[model samples]
Target: MATRRKEYRFRNGKIIEIEENHDGNYGAPGQKRIKKKKPTEEQMRLVNINNKVKRCRHKLLEYFNAGDCFGTWTYSQANRPPDMKAALKDFQKTIRIVRIEYKKRNRELFWIRNIERGTKGAWHIHFVVNEIGDTASIMQKAWKKGGIYAVEIRNEPKVYDEDFSKLAAYMTKDEHTKEIKKDGTPAKPRLKETSYNTSRNMPLKKPHVDKLVRWKNEVKPRKGYYIISIHEGINPVTGFKYRRYTMVRFPEPKRKVQLKRRI
Candidate 1:
């Protein structure tokens, strides 16, 4: 009765999340509430980054698939952005040009981007944009202030079981390093805020919620769907077992053509 499972179905794959409801009546209405220990700053930071990465990965799975562009834009020392705001402005300028190019061809561009400033003050942008032909060329022309490295999201993945998980993790990584300030004092490690920007045309995916009256441990994929990744974990709060996995259905093979009889 306390178990809830959610299924997010995407074009190429699906994600499953199972959790135990912790809203049960642990105390009576009149009982004084006991204050719980606050989570440390580092713990909170990690949780936020994890949630952002998960959300971004699901969105990637929902709208974009193989052949989409995964790109990194870096600035030269001369043209590097002076601040995070300037970096964002530069990204906007580039995307605006890209959108116009797509519009000229009677198409709309959907993109997700994350910008980060390194500890050494180097600013860069990581983006995943839907490719509708001429994507790489368009990117190269649009972002003139920096070096652009764009590659198609491969249909076959060498590291992860699925295609986009590794890419998503790499793009949303919260890289940080310790450093000493010019004043001979320790400085806060620059943490890449786990956030992303999206084009207005991006789709908001909603998952189907299922309440499992009878819990089943066995997971079986539907016909034509193959399980690619499986993860099992226990909730520290409830001590309940929860598990999730992804199922991907490959494109069906094309039917062979037959030659007409000579007679």
Candidate 2:
């Protein structure tokens, strides 16, 4: 009887051939099989960090869509810009001041802040914020340590999704701040930086997970909270599959009580 052969192409463009003998054996006898190496500790740590960053970005997007997001704004550095670390500190302090003043006026504010490098390699600030009244002027006045600023309210629903995805992609893009040396070691220790920030009062995401049943079955109809989105991924460290649900909880609806005694 003639043997049947099959070929498989991997993502790396490697072609592997397999033959079946009369006895239904796949590989030839004494042919050693190459085993996949487990991920190194450093690699696993990097994977975990990547997953965490992605989840945080998605949560920020969910927060933006679940409620009213005022707009997206950018703040550029002035002619004499401070160091990145110092500039970030000053930026955060200004934001806190803005939040405090807004609250004093009995207005609520929520913000998602992102820091990025501009075309000239200068650090800039981006924010998706919700605040009562006109905030662009206030932000401009507060961020006096920068050059120019712009704010555009997100009008269209489709634009929100597009902008959200773009922001997430930008935040997660490969960072060029660190370089790899020829010896496979990093040239210098990367400076710790906050990629993004969110308001403290932002809604906390609720996770609903079920292995044997669908997501709908696992999540019940809650009064204050509603499901925003669901994401499925494998844990990089444990390799365990999981389904994460992003939920938004609003102020509970008021219930009416009957006056039975009067009746």
Candidate 3:
């Protein structure tokens, strides 16, 4: 017996030839199986950066509720900003020193370092740090790598009045896009490092699913925890849609004891 084959042509001028398998299934041999496309370097970079940004946002929201202050620290020089490698080195040393100094206060400091280009086309570091005492002085004193300029620390407004999403967006704006250097070279290819850095003290968020019915209902206040924000989106990795409810757990409330009266 001779097996019949069929050839199909598409509008794109492409042809697909299919033959019957031994089991009588019609396909191009193993065509019934689905193959996943591998992501390119650029695509991988974008995905990584996006995930980092999301994690940062979640952490920021959590830390802010704990009364942590937010501020920015910049590194610059008279000639130009320090190179990425040198700037990162200085940042690491600065964080180490800051931790040691703040150890006495028993407070944890969280930071995210963003590398950006200044108006003068110089590479500089724009760092966002959680509340720490005398942060400007500590960072300025630690950064001695040269081109040391003023380290400005500006307090962020109240969390309720501010849009936290902008923080992540600002840090990662145009990060995935390709840029051209003054020398007519692609800057993206040269950027082999991450766009941002975070402190090890920062906690990771574990999101839980919420009932779809509660989408429009106000979140109820619990005794030891409260809802910070709710976000709904499709998971890129798993391709599953989910509604995430972010909650901040706090210390247990102190209970009042009543003395019993004797009859």
RMSD of 2: 14.4
The residue pairs that clash in candidate 1, if any, are: none
Residues 21-122 of candidate 1 have per-residue lDDT tens digits of: 322223224565434556677767766765676777777777787778888888989998767777888888888999999999898888988787776777
Question: What digit string (tens of lDDT, one per residue) describes model 2 on residues 135-155?
Answer: 766776776655544445345
Rate residue 165 of model 3 by lDDT. 57
Question: What are the runs in model 3 whose C-alpha is more than 4 Å off?
Answer: 1-46, 61-66, 75-79, 104-106, 118-120, 140-164, 172-174, 177-194, 203-228, 233-242, 247-263
RMSD over all Cα atoms, model 1: 6.2
- C-alpha lDDT (0 to 100) for residue 33 of candidate 1: 42
Q: Model 3 over residues 70-178: C-alpha lDDT tens digits?
A: 4445444553434667656666776788778777678777777666554455565555665565765666666554443333222343222232555665555443445
lDDT of each: 0.70, 0.50, 0.49
Pairwise TM-score winner, candidates 1 and 2 = 1
Best by lDDT: 1
Once fitted onto the true fold, the runs of candidate 2 whose alpha carbons sit more than 4 angstroms away are 1-38, 41-46, 66-81, 117-121, 152-163, 172-194, 213-263
